[model samples]
Target: MTKDPTIAIRDCLAEIAVLHGIAAQKTLHEFRNDAVARRAAAYAIQTISEAVRRIPEDWLADFPTEPWGQIKGIGNRLRHEYFRVDDGILWEIMTTDMHALKTVREAMLARHAGAS
Candidate 1:
């Protein structure tokens, strides 16, 4: 059976929170210099991407602001264009976009929790 869509949203929120924690540990300069942090972030982004993709289309329609297409594209780029990945861009995107994603996801979870 297909996994529940809400579970994917929860996973996305969890990964975003984890990525924020990683970002907290370092400045952009420090993040670029730290291989472990960078790798962890990449994995988190990949997970977030996958989780976003897993969200059902109907449920995703409820959050129209999210750029699900581009989010999935980022994961593809990370996987297939690994060598060309820019640390600065990754750091910037994570720090900038994550807040919006997290907020909506938290609301999504809350909305679902109330439904259940």
Candidate 2:
């Protein structure tokens, strides 16, 4: 059975939110210093990016303002160029970019719910 793209995106967003919340109280240094937390964040980011990539382009077109390409690119980099992962950029993404994605995900979910 095929999974709904909206649900997949929501799941990924929720995972990212949970992982971010786990590391929310820590400083960048603390986050970077902890291998487990760092790996969790990276995995969550990759997951979210992968989901974003799978979502249909027409569906994505509805949200013209979201950075879908960049988000998908980050996932590509994370999956393909694992060696060059920058903790600082990851920290910045977790702190800033993710909130926007979460908001968008919530909107998508609500829209999907209404359409159902």
Candidate 3:
């Protein structure tokens, strides 16, 4: 069985994203003030961004269902507009946005795994 690059990247990213979500949920209260939680959340977003960035164009083409561009766009915004980021938006993204991403990741993973 040939290993697909897109699936590999997606699986790796999904795992990290799940970890980030878990961490974010665990520190929902403390994240408002705790430096560690803030940093961790930032790092989590960064990693998710990196995953999106690393996805090759060909691989992106294969997964029509996933919001590859949007995910990367958010990452670009976060990376470029660090100081201008609003906490409320970030909180909403972490909670609501991440769940949507999680669904996409799961669907892609299931499809790829089934294909294999």
lDDT of 2 by residue, 47-100 (tens): 888888767677788899998888888888988887899899889888888888
| Regions of model 3 farther than 4 Å from truth | 1-29, 56-66, 114-116
What TM-score would candidate 3 get against the native?
A: 0.65
Give candidate 3's error at residue 76 in angstroms: 2.3
Pairs in steric clash, model 2: none
lDDT of 3 by residue, 1-116 (tens): 44454655565465457546655566556556666655556567766766766555654566687777777776677788877776656666677777767766565566556444
Residue pairs in collision within model 1: none
Best by TM-score: 1
Lowest-lDDT window of 10 residues in candidate 1? 107-116
What alpha-carbon RMSD in Å does predicted model 1 have with respect to the real structure?
1.5
How should the candidates be ordered by lDDT, best one leading?
A: 1, 2, 3
Report the C-alpha lDDT of model 1 over 1-116, residue by residue, as the tens digit.
Answer: 87777888889888998889988888999999999989889989999988888877777788888898989889999999978999987898779989999998888888776442
- C-alpha RMSD by candidate, in order: 1.5, 1.7, 4.0
Clashes of 2: 0
